[model samples]
Target: MTAPEDLALYVHWPFCVSKCPYCDFNSHVRAEVDQAAWRDALLADLRHEVALLPGRRLRSVFFGGGTPSLMPPATVAAVLDAAVAAWTPAGDLEVTLEANPSSVEAARFADLARVGVNRVSLGMQSLDDDALRFLGRAHDAREGLAALDVAQRVFPRVSFDLIYALPGQAMRAWKAELARALAFGTEHLSLYQLTIEPGTRFATEAAAGRIVIPDGDTAADLFELTRAMTAAAGLPAYETSNHARPGAESRHNLAYWRYRDYAGIGPGAHGRRGRLATTRRRKPENWLTAVSRNGHGIEREDPLDPHTRAVEALLMGLRLTEGIDLDRIARLAGGEAPVDSRAVALLERQGLLARNGAHLRVTDAGALLLDGILGAVVRAQTAVAV
Candidate 1:
């Protein structure tokens, strides 16, 4: 049997050269930063948390950003060393760092690889130059391709992200981009659709009629088209927005979707462990102050109930090509699988769910309506169980 996969660590680097108009991630830009002080604070926080849960085997460590690739190599090296000192790393623990497709960042790839970063997820949000300009990305397509060439030479695994279904996007345009992306021989790709999230500049502009997006039906078609193209190419959707070949699935992300425990350190990072979900303070100074308070943040910490876990597990697992395991669901929820017959029957009749003995899997149609289906089922089951 596979060894128990329990632990992971996340290190958030809160600085960016510039923040994208569409990005709502906890990132900031400043004229100058106290790199040494920030590094010391992060390392100290790691040690403090390690004292709380010592000797757990770490399955992964993901350096999510603003832009982790911008950090000085020595800082990355120090944190990796600190983590190894604190926990036993899995035999093949996956360590990933989010990057941007810029040559300056690419120059540090060799040093980062030497310090144990094996996977690279580059933010090539769009390849078309016009769309690139529309999104205000720093690197052009040529620069991005050059960076990808360098990364492919340095890292064993390289993944790139592309945003699709823009204002005037068509199926043909997306297919061409996906084909070109796949040609790079990347083992994983994150194909996201553009979303005008609240509080984003895009949202504000859109509300003022400055930007227009595809109609609902057209966006739906793009989603379906993405699924079909990737499936044909053997890069299947392993999550709602990511596609990967068989063995190339992101271990760090899977840890979350699988409802496993992980530690989060640094400003604005979120984590869940031992039924408790914690979010670090969003501001850098505030996070440092909170870390001095018994290794927790001042912002928020919520303990998830049993029912909540079950609902979360279903929402996460159903996104995978392999759906939920009934026995595992029962174990996590502290009860038998509460499959609501009405919702199940309705979904199955609509050809949106399949039952493999005890396991219930979401079909492609169901995946399209995942939120609605999950809500109906969870509501029905939650009431029954309550």
Candidate 2:
């Protein structure tokens, strides 16, 4: 289905059962939460934000986390209800929730599905028991599969995540995991590389040379293998780290990659509307208080320049196999993309990028070198404009 024009909503649930050592998201583990109070605060904040973007048809609503599945299903339903009440929903609008796989969560699948969440993306980071433990995941392979089974039975569409390119991972091992995951008959899959972001335990360990991750070259090779295997399985990378069968791509995520307008609600959430951008308060309690006191909890707001928007679009869109749509970029930028013709030409010669009519796409080789290519392309554009 085609995306509805120009709008989506992101509802952030910034609480988790426990924090993973490698995670650096705006999530916290707390012994208790006042669900009713939280429900009221988030609903108020969301309605206020919706007031700001009135008349926009919302195409999708994503309940992203800490661990959204941990939220009481009643609270989840309340947010979903508030979303529809606040805006117009397009045909086949998708409501998605991010959850972690565990038998406990599996039991809640039916409850979530009943509350307008027709899509469920569960975090099943690895199928190997050892890998799961190493990643500090709470579930074992059996529990993960059990949860997936429950999610598939309850939801119309189900997606699960897996992480590859771990330390000491080999091509054969990764391929085996991919094959097994595909065998689960999931319509959508997310295979991500293990990134050691600063402030994460993984990064701290790596810095002291106590932990070892795969080298850059090895990671690149594993990435290529992932693409080939997924494509062969009839699932292509519609966006970076996401693979899905035709018509199964996440609409909510597509809303982000397409650079459409979306409202972010919840602690530490970010929102963009045309050129104006806003970030919500990062602390849950503070957010609730601000919303109660002033009808909203926005902490920072600014308008981005056209060039910055274009650069963001390029950064996000190139991750898709279909690459950047020139028309969309032009419409958003209010002018043509400021890409350097010479840089694109050089990339074409290097088999890193290919021009297709009005769009520019990264080749298989280009996807392999995306980290470097993005920097080079941005610098070339800067130099050419100068």
Candidate 3:
């Protein structure tokens, strides 16, 4: 069990050079950004979070963004310095920064590494030039690879992401791409199936019949192939979309999936701290203004009830291959069982779920239909409990 004193920090950098067509994250494109103002505002925001959650041992700090690579290394350093001052850092504190594969950002890798960023998650959306263009990535395949090489050289741990099951993507091409990615010998990879998020350009295109992703059967086949190939490469699927060799799973992400406390700072960041859910102002200027006025930019702070927290914990924890601890879920639900025992027995009978003492896990086949499975189990439990 994770101790309550263990916490994670997530810092959001909301500006981007260009917004991807498929992205619905709170990211923005701006002609000019006042880096100095942003730096001060972010530091102030972090201090406010520190005051709220005092005496925690920070396990990890993740610099995520519209494009965190665009942030000046000094700003990154300042934030890290503040965090160190505010809380005790774990002996192996994992500081990860997300970067784009653009040459400009790649050039800053060494400086970023110098400033205590030990891990880099590069946004190499695709390795194929055509797919890169379709994904609205600024870097070509060659440039992306070059940036990846730079990241691997500078950062102690490097993870790159690729989007698959894209419109018109052939299974053979995807397999070849996966092979190429694995050949890089990086410890971690995040392979996501393309989804047309609502309100994004991709969603609009899909709704208008301008785009078509792989059908369900074909997508499932691609997913299975990805799992098989990654496993063969010794980087098994630790989470649904993330693959890592043993002991290489993302610590910051794991903190979230394990339903631990984390402090979120900066525009558009969402965080869970105890029973409270915190969110910051979504717009850059609005966030800055709020920070200047209130010492933090948080736009909403809602307390989650026990049942809601348990449900959320279950949803996130079940995504992992290791699955959830049923005892922990029950505790979160105020000593009530989090799932129906009969439902678990039925699912285990159906080969969709398995139990290893107190740990409850979704089978590989059940993971493909995770939403429906979770709904059924939760409904069954709630119905009987009520």
lDDT of 2 by residue, 1-386 (tens): 55435588898899988778789999988899999998998898898888888877878889998999988899989988888877888778898999999887788889898888999999999999999988999999999988998898899999999998888888899989999999988999999999888898888889999778889899988988888889999888887789999999998888778777899999989988778888999988888888889888899999897777877888888878888876676565657675766788899999999998788988888988887777766532343232
Backbone Cα, N, C clashes tallied per candidate: 0, 0, 0
lDDT for position 239 in model 2: 78
| lDDT (10s digit) by residue, model 1, range 317-363 | 87776888877877767775555768888888998888777688888
lDDT of each: 0.85, 0.86, 0.92
User: Which candidate wins on TM-score?
Assistant: 3
Please list the residue runs of candidate 1 whose C-alpha ends up more than 4 Å from where it truly belongs after superposition.
1-5, 292-298, 380-386
lDDT (C-alpha) at residue 342 in model 2 = 78
Query: Lowest-lDDT window of 10 residues in candidate 3?
Result: 377-386
Global lDDT for candidate 2? Answer: 0.86
Ranking by TM-score: 3, 2, 1
TM-score pick, better of 1 and 3: 3
What digit string (tens of lDDT, one per residue) describes model 3 on residues 169-278?
99999999999999999999999999989999999999999999999999999999999999999999989999999999999999999999999999999999898999
| Model with the higher TM-score, candidate 2 or 3 | 3
Instruction: Please report the TM-score between candidate 1 and the true structure.
Output: 0.95
